[model samples]
Target: MITTKLYNRYQTVIPSEIRKKISVDPDSIVEWTINEKGKVELEFRKRLTEKDIIGLIKQELPYNSVEIKKRSGRGLDWE
Candidate 1:
């Protein structure tokens, strides 16, 4: 079992090996919650902002003429 000590500020390092295995980076946001068995659980999640949406639009994607026609109010059979 991995062991760690609480520092004077009550902060503890999650151990480099464990962090590497879990793919967690420094200063990454983590959520700690308790499960039904009172076991601690950690989850990594990133919040999306307006900038993220713009970046998604800038990213490469498949073309969709059907969607374009529908969006333009054109009569296009989409069967």
Candidate 2:
């Protein structure tokens, strides 16, 4: 296992090897959690914005447009 020393203000630098493996960058978000066994788990999350989602949607949709499905009936139909 890799070990690191806790510096002032309880901050420690994540090792380069770990960072490379996880593809972490300056803007990456890190999540920390403690389980019932009192073991700490770290999760990496990539930050995304509405603009990013719109771009992804454009790529996924046909002709770069959003198609809404419509029903014939006016009200909700329950069988």
Best by TM-score: 2
Candidate 2 vs. true structure, TM-score: 0.62
In order, the Cα lDDT scores of the candidates are 0.70, 0.70
Given candidate 2, what's the lDDT at residue 13? 89
The alpha-carbon deviation from the true structure for residue 18 of candidate 1, after best TM-score superposition, in angstroms, is 1.0
lDDT of 2: 0.70
**TM-score, candidate number 1:** 0.55
Candidate 1, residues 1-79, lDDT tens digits: the string is 9999999999998888888887876657889999999999989766544334443454366646456545446655534
Q: What is the Å distance of residue 24 in model 1 from its true position?
A: 1.3
* Clash list (residue pairs), candidate 1: none
